[model samples]
Target: MSLAELIDQPEFGHHESPRHQTRRVLLLGNDDRVLLAVARGLGRNGISVDVAWCDPDSPALKSQYVHAFHSVVPYSPHDDQWLDGLHRLVKQYDYDLVIPCNDYAVVPLQLEREKLDPDTHWYLINDDAFQVAFDKAKTSRVASELGINVPRECEITDADVRSGFSNREFSLPDRRSLRFPVYVKPRSSITASDVTNKRSAQRVDSPDALAEYLIHEFPHDGVLIQESFSGVGIGVEILAHQGKVLMQIQHQRLRETIDGGSTYRETIAELPELTEATRKLVQHLNYTGVGMFEFRYNRETGDWVFLEINARFWGSLPLAIAAKANFPFALYELLVKGQTNFHTNHTIGVRCRNLINDLRAFRHQKAEEFDLENLLFGKDYLDFYAPDDWRPQLATLVHFARSVLGKFTRRIGFSV
Candidate 1:
């Protein structure tokens, strides 16, 4: 049987026949602002939600938007214990859907599909989904296969790590023809967070520098060397249903914590080509969830090469929600209503805000990153904690206070 089919089989002991029904959904990766926003969106739309994560300060735990909250060690979604936990939680609550808002959470959940409630459907892609999106080498290959534009690249392996940085016959010698100033990234075993701390990657201006990076910094294997694309980085958020894209929202980074790093200030954009390209790629993958496609514009090549695909909800979700393309609501509709008769027609303006308190390190490095005016008074997106409901609004304030106190204590001598 195919991987998607195998993973899609009902595991709750019975099936509900995919009917339009109000659902009790579980949201994972709790402390994430994106996940909190998703839960708020779903809750506002009347879908009951429960939250689980490792952090005590998970806003979902204290937020009025959630039905219940659980804190525990974040186990590998691939681990049987994780599956057991999921099964127990779903059985205990009789949840009908599981919505994961983080990439790490999605992969393991997809791997252990047999543990999910059969009555529950997951708003996620399958193992092949990870194969196509998260793994950079595989993503490039698959994009190339579909005639989708990707960087010309070569993979570096463990053998390359053992050998000194010499272009010998044992190595893929065909990379000799590639031009200088190529971008070298680890094929696997590294993440965005690694790039900030590790001196592994180098902007090699020549083959010697590439060899140097390989010898000293990038000693680990599973790397990729690709033609560097330098352009204004734009991200596209998409909601897809069984290979069809239902909504697309684009954003252009105004500023970020690190040069050529993740965004701290972004504005909604209108890019038809990006939207269409992301739509086509997801359709080919038969994606049935929320996803983001990150692309870097290469001024030299004048092409937008595919960078990565985030298979779950993305960071700038409130921006999309403000623009009327509500991903969380859409996922809820798919699981509960089965279809939404709604159409988005809102144009959310620019926004700039701090990353969630849990992302303290990022926010600390870039505390003054945002345009204060835009962050404080933007009419575009609603602040996650600034609820219109008085009760919930107070709860949000309390959550913020606790988060600040926790960070303050951590700053002193206490470990967070």
Candidate 2:
């Protein structure tokens, strides 16, 4: 039978002998891919999954593993109505746990943990530590103090803000200090409520480009201007309870978007430097739940520079699951079962691709380092095309087409 047909089969959630208890989990995030992966991961392990998202047509809604779906206020820094809605859902459904899958959702929940139902368990870092992690500048300073390598950064000045697209050429305190091709990004990873065009990071080749971006693109926003590191992006995903790490998995980005987001990545054996750095950071924060520490591996120096910590499930979570890390299930066990037999070891060299976004990368011609031949013929795990749950894959295609059409219509002065 086809995967779609099998989604409705009676045996979908009827495991003969369940490994984990049947606890209802409410997952929060708009990223359907991450939601779908978590749903399947926990659902198959005998946990009931419910999803709350802003988009009604999200692919996670189509997953058979999701017992219920609810539309809540979209992720925003200032909005707290979603919390009220979530409280009602928790009271109504008596969900055993609440999991926020993105930083946008994670931060708000962390800030208002007291407002949430005390009976409902949520694994998250404390607000004080999260504050340090959320801000790039603060994170870099803390990591550096901890004896971890971090990209050199300069403080933004009031003069820089006042310059604001002026004719006067702007210059840094130490003009010769920074190498060319530095990155200019928001000081804090969280997007401001008033900001319309949100960006992760921008690479600026010249000082002129850097000044122009800060003045024009994000005039009112606080930004970090840092010396860009030349290296490959590596993510070390860890699941911790209190101050102790339960599991850690490493993945190397093979290809990413033009700006800087992983599209293709593969599981790799843990490196001592990367592993040690991650442990130090996580322990320092006394973080609970799942977090991924991103690093830049300088090929020439063999040094690992700490980037930032994502205090929630990351985009490439499915890749970790595909390599047998099973973070979602591990999280469920930790939060609900009170203990877990968490395993850190995972199969190395197992590649995982987000096919839809990979296509976007291919369209932009950005992933030059990726071998087209390997993408075509090599054995790999696909994020969306799961054998037991194929409908989300189809949903992804439809969503992509609709998005492209929407962009086209807007360009041509039409509306869809």
Candidate 3:
């Protein structure tokens, strides 16, 4: 039987008829691996998936699962063009659901929620909840109130901006109370409008370096000076509806890129303390849809410190799906069918790696010797290498090659 026919059968448990009813989803953001995984998952479940992205050559655009592709201006907090284009696409295609794949897309969509097609549903947290989750300072304060451990941080205020110290070199403050190697990052998540100098996070050894970074790197942006937490990164992903948790999974980071992004991770049993803290935080925020709570677990202290919450689909979504969490399908059922029937029990010890980024991580590690065979066989899953869908992987490789070539040409004072 055909795929549609199978989905329509009584045994398949889908309520919609393949001939008369088909759910449509419009996913925002294009370059992310999570976006491609979401499209493939929803498409296989009989949903007509459409894609919107800023780049014409994004990996998701090459996926066969995408029924249509629309080019929109990249996400920015002040851009109305993207919002207008999204509304037009929803009206044009009569999309049943709209899901933002990243924080850049989520913030604007939440801010302009009422301006879009009201009939169309969104897989997003409420505006108030989004505000709490988006700001790192606010998230830390709230999580701490719920008895969750969070790193101590000091917020840079307008007063600090006016102190003239922002322009002048300054010495370190008293080091008696503060720890060395504190981290400095934006108070809120980075948006597309931020320039290259405005990084997500930077580690500073002394107060002078912190002051220098605040002046040079993020002079205008609000920043948080947080104590550096030493530990392994753990992510607790939860899918919820109106404060009720539907599915949850936990993964431990095994390797990270030079920039501190996860490259290799494995599913693991949920830690009770971490799980309870996540539940309390999500429930307090009344968050809806999919969210991931990141933490730093110190093995010596047995402390799980809250990092921040991603209020949308995460980059490591494929690992969760591969381990049998099936977040994409659960989201579809929750939004379209008014109920979710997926199990949250995922297989532990299943490792997933983003092969390209893992290479970067490996280079950063600089081992004495390399073991090619062990590296190839150790990973249970790769983020973008499915046998059935080859085009996206090919597209990503081409994209990476072109990027490298462009950088090389620029360095050599030539243009191609």
TM-scores of all predicted structures: 0.74, 0.85, 0.86
Residue 334, model 3, lDDT: 88
Error of 1 at 145 (Å): 2.5
- Candidate 2 overall Cα lDDT vs. reference? 0.76
Q: Tell me how far the alpha carbon of residue 317 in candidate 1 is from the true structure, in angstroms, after superposition.
A: 1.3
Per-residue alpha-carbon lDDT of model 1 for 297-389, expressed as tens digits? Answer: 654666787777878787767666655667888877765667834465646455534334224435556655444454456542433544442
Which pairs in model 1 have colliding backbones?
11-118, 12-117, 12-118, 187-222, 187-223
RMSD of each: 9.3, 4.7, 6.5
Q: Which stretches of candidate 2 lie over 4 Å from their true place?
A: 1-21, 74-80, 157-160, 163-176, 192-197, 219-221, 366-378, 401-416
Tell me which residue pairs clash in candidate 3.
none
Q: Tell me the spans in candidate 3 whose CA falls farther than 4 Å from its real position.
A: 1-21, 73-80, 164-176, 191-199, 219-221, 367-375, 402-416
TM-score winner, 1 or 3: 3
Query: What TM-score does structure 3 among the candidates reach?
Result: 0.86
What would the per-residue lDDT of candidate 2 be over residues 1-416, giving only the tens digit for each residue? Answer: 86545433332233223223457788887776788788888988888887775356676667778777776765455666767777777777666788887765676677667777777677577887788888877887788889998877765655667756465344455564567788886866555453233457788888778767766776354777777788899999988987788898898998788888888899988888988888888888887888889999977889768888887888898898888888999888887778856656689998988888887887787545655666678477778867787777777777677789998989888542
Best by lDDT: 2
